[model samples]
Each structure stands twice: as structure tokens, then as C-alpha cells.
Target: MRLDLGAIAKAGTSKANQTGSWRNFKPIFHQEKCIGCSLCKIYCPEGCVTMVEKKKYTVDYTYCKGCGICAEECSSSDIEMVMEEK
Candidate 1:
């Protein structure tokens, strides 16, 4: 099966929008591993994690310090800390 390049491009754009500040810091959420628990949101000292909807969370790196607390406290091993590309 051939891949749809347009769809891939759109998906990339959507991911970029969802993950703001791609140049500063990034939070990689492993959805398959995420158990829909809100521990990350609770442990985030910066209060950057927000529930966009039920069972869905987003990190606001615009204020995040890349402290990795979310990744550390994620019982499901879903959250990961990643450095942003310069």
C-alpha cells in the first residue's frame, strides 16, 4: 500500500501544533503506555500540563523547565523528556 504524502504532511503539522515550542523543550507522551492517569499533571511543578480533553493531556513547554518530574512520576512510563532541536 502506498502512503499518502499529503496526509503525512498534515499529520506532522498537527503534531507540531499540539507540541508547542518545538525549538525549546519537548515532552514525548507514549499514548500506548499512558494509562489516562493525571499524575503527570499533578507532579508538574511548572503547572504546564493541561487536560485538553478527557483522557488527553498536553504539556506547555513555553513555561516548562524540562525538569523531567512528569517523566519520573509517570507510573505508566508514558511520559518522556526530550531536548528540543536548536
Candidate 2:
């Protein structure tokens, strides 16, 4: 099936705006350490993290702001904080 690239792009842009602060903060997910509890996704104020697959989660950095809430909320220490270059 053919996909609407323009609609997808627009949706992506809109989602980015919803979490633009995340661009300043990057989330490092340690798969080996992650228990797949999804705590990080639950506590993210920006709601940036989403289930990418069965056991993996993806973080949307566009609005993350490096708040470290995900890291703090992570019970397994799966998520780490890194500096973003402006």
C-alpha cells in the first residue's frame, strides 16, 4: 500500500513541537539493563517515550529538556542522561 509521505511528515513535525524541549536532552536506553517495566515511559512529563516494539521503548527527544525524570523513575537504571550540543 502506498503511504502518504506528506501526512507522515506533518504528523512528525507536530509531534516534535509537542516535545521540542526533548531535543536538548538525549535518553540512553540500556537494553541489557532494561527490564521492560516501562517506568520511564510512564513518568516522562512530555510523554516522549513510546513502545517501539514488544520489549523496546523509544524516546522522542524533541521536547525532553534533559529533565532526567525518566532516569529517576527508571527502576532498572535502563535510561541514562546525556548532554545535548546546542
Candidate 3:
């Protein structure tokens, strides 16, 4: 017998699973350095980054996978990835 599985994952299903629990490094947002370009939010693969205000952004650790995409994509170099204490 053969099992059939779709190639693409269903949309909005990732929210049900919290993938941030095992991340070794987490992205830190610097309020002062941020230029509010929204690069971090646009590049996040897990869709964990969010905009708090016009020039401010925050990350939802519950769904963030610590992939460093946010930090790399930051136009102002405001996001930093630091080792998780736990």
C-alpha cells in the first residue's frame, strides 16, 4: 500500500504547533536602533514577527523557530539573535 500526502502544508495550521520551545537562539529587537522598515516581519518564515506600532516591532516567541531570518533581514540591523538561557 502507498500513502498519499500533499506537497504543501495547509495554511493557518502552523499556529496550532508551538515550534519555539526547542530553539537555542532567539531574536532580540532593539527599539532604539530599529528604523521601522518592517524587514524582519516580512522575512520571518514562521510569521512570528509583528509590528507593534509605526516604527516598532515585536516577535511572538511561541511560534518563532529562531531561524535568524529576522536578524539577517533587518535593514537597520536592530534585531539580534542571542542564546536562549534555558
Candidate 4:
């Protein structure tokens, strides 16, 4: 079996570069308000939002661009959109 490694596969090149600065807004997750809908995870463009538990999710800010896709897609309004603070 062969592994499908794409893009910068080197550890140095991949870990040294971060992509979180490309956003004008950031998404904040409300654990209490979340309904385990999983919409945020599906709509995240960067795939930074991951389900850490049955009803909880975590965002990897290292690569998240503050896109509001997750917030917009959230039917329960569990994700809130806020301006990114420099």
C-alpha cells in the first residue's frame, strides 16, 4: 500500500509555516450552545475545526483563516463570528 502524501511533506517546511494570519474575522465556538450539529466542521474551509468529542469541537488556529463559513453554516448558532484582534 502507498500513502498519499500531498504538498509540503517535509516536517521543517510544514511546521515552520503557519496560516492563521489570513483572516479578518475569527470564529468562536460556544460549547454550551452547540447542539452537536457538526455543521461547523463540515463548512470550515481550512478543515481546522475538528470534533474532539461527541458534542464538542476544537479549532486549530494555526491554520484557520478566521473565515465565517462555520458560523454561517451553524444552524443552532453555536459558532459566533468576531473580529480578529491583532
Overall local distance difference test of candidate 1? 0.71
Query: Taking the tens digit of each residue's C-alpha lDDT, what string does model 2 give over 4-60?
Result: 866454444555354554366577876667778898888887777888776678776
Q: Which residue ranges in model 4 land beyond 4 Å of their true spot?
A: 1-16
Task: Identify the leading candidate in terms of TM-score.
Answer: 3
Q: What's the best-to-worst order under lDDT? A: 3, 4, 2, 1
- lDDT against the true structure, per candidate, is 0.71, 0.73, 0.85, 0.81
Candidate 3 at 3: error in angstroms? Answer: 14
Which candidate number would show the highest lDDT if scored against the true structure?
Answer: 3
Question: Per-residue lDDT of 1-86 in model 1, one digit per residue for the tens?
Answer: 56896645444343334334433546787666777789989998767789877667778766666777888888888887777775
Give candidate 1's TM-score.
Answer: 0.63
> What TM-scores do the predictions have?
0.63, 0.67, 0.80, 0.77
Which scores higher on lDDT, 1 or 3?
3
Model 3 scores worst on lDDT over the 10 consecutive residues at: 1-10
